[model samples]
Target: MARLLDLRQLDLEQIDAVHGRGTSWLYPLAAAMSGATAGIVISGGQLATATSAGAAAAPSGAAIAGAFVSDAALVLGLASRSVGHISLLYGYDPEEPAEKLFILSVVNAGTAASASAKTAALSDISRLTQSLVRGKTWEVLDRSVISQVSKQFSKAFGKRLTKQGLGKVVPAVGVLVGFTLNWTTLESIVDVADVEYRRRFLIEKYPHLANEEIPETFSDDLSDDADEAISVLNELAEAGGPDLR
Candidate 1:
């Protein structure tokens, strides 16, 4: 199965700040992701410190994320391209264990940017001095397409879409369409097979989710065709197989 590892907010070292957005965004995101995979453990490395008299430095998750990225490269091991982006790990916790939750906002924003900014961004990074730069590809998405699939999946799953909670729920809903898979349905509905729906689903489903009120500025971006397709697939699965759907 295609796994979307959640390392969104795990960067404790903040090393990527040195590289700027382009590739920097990649190191922290990918490293924590790879580390979360099977058998991957943190090295607890020390970060570079200011040039001063031997001042001891504390280890960081940022170091972990960075080391993990390096290790994956050293092993000459790459995830199957068919796996697509291999999940985008993000978020960085301030405390220990560094609650490195994946920041879904970036992905949600990234999908839109792919249409409006992808070409220029890629061109700028590649230094490909050319005028024919195309690929403002996100224009292909339509509201109906997004709403249709969104509603379809909602009906199938029979779950209510409310506010942005926090932790798991926040990240899960935001990144539902990040990759190509059935995560939407997988996360949307909870099995009613148990009593105490609140305990089994809401309160316990993802206990870390914040109780913050839904942002007044909320949006359901179904304008991206890629997002829409993934949404439909997730709904189908959540609704149940042919026996259920």
Candidate 2:
């Protein structure tokens, strides 16, 4: 039997190699897969229409929106898994699975929300990133604290789902809307992961300079313009439409 790969045991160089290969195509593919899945699930069969007075009523946008939420969850989970690996590679201890999961969850939550709603989420992610770099123990965060954080994130996630549903209100264009939303969301998540991991990587490589704030240097390497992408998504969410073209 083929042995399972243990990501925790992999050294930085090995981890980098694995991540590079895995993420190069993973985000796009996952986004496409999730979008297609959402479109199909939402548009499949007669679920998109109801018979009434010998006329088929337009499919309920709410139904499509509901399907999108279920599909987006899977995409977010995949992105978070990559974020966890990057965290481990950047010196976070693998023994602290809860902490790692929490970080990933926060990052995903931040990526999902509109820019206007992202301030608190981003702040939380930054604090957690800093703590991880400082080697803080997970025990410092009690269950109540974790519960509260989880509740806040849950609310943010719900808002995001609502926005997504509103964006796909037109049943005729469900496929395109779903595709754009998933792709943009995953792209945003990847950018956040890159920044967080790169920051930690710099801190570990130059321990002497750890006390100094490192200048942001990874923007040139990002696949998408992060600010522009987030801004567009926020506008879309605010307008409650999917003019993503």
Candidate No. with top TM-score: 2
> What lDDT is obtained when candidate 1 is compared to the true structure?
0.24
Lowest lDDT sum, 10 consecutive residues, model 1, at: 96-105
What TM-score does candidate 1 reach?
0.18
For each candidate in the order shown, give its overall lDDT on alpha carbons.
0.24, 0.52
In angstroms, how far off is 180's CA in candidate 1? 25
Candidate 1 residue-wise lDDT at 6 = 31
List where candidate 2 sits over 4 angstroms from the true fold: 1-18, 41-62, 91-98, 105-119, 140-148, 205-211, 215-245
**Could you tell me the TM-score of candidate 2?**
0.63
Highest lDDT: give the candidate number.
2
C-alpha lDDT of residue 151 in model 1? 52
lDDT of 2 by residue, 7-124 (tens): 4334557656756645535775787667766765565423345434222544456766567667756765666665665565555543353454345444544454434335444444
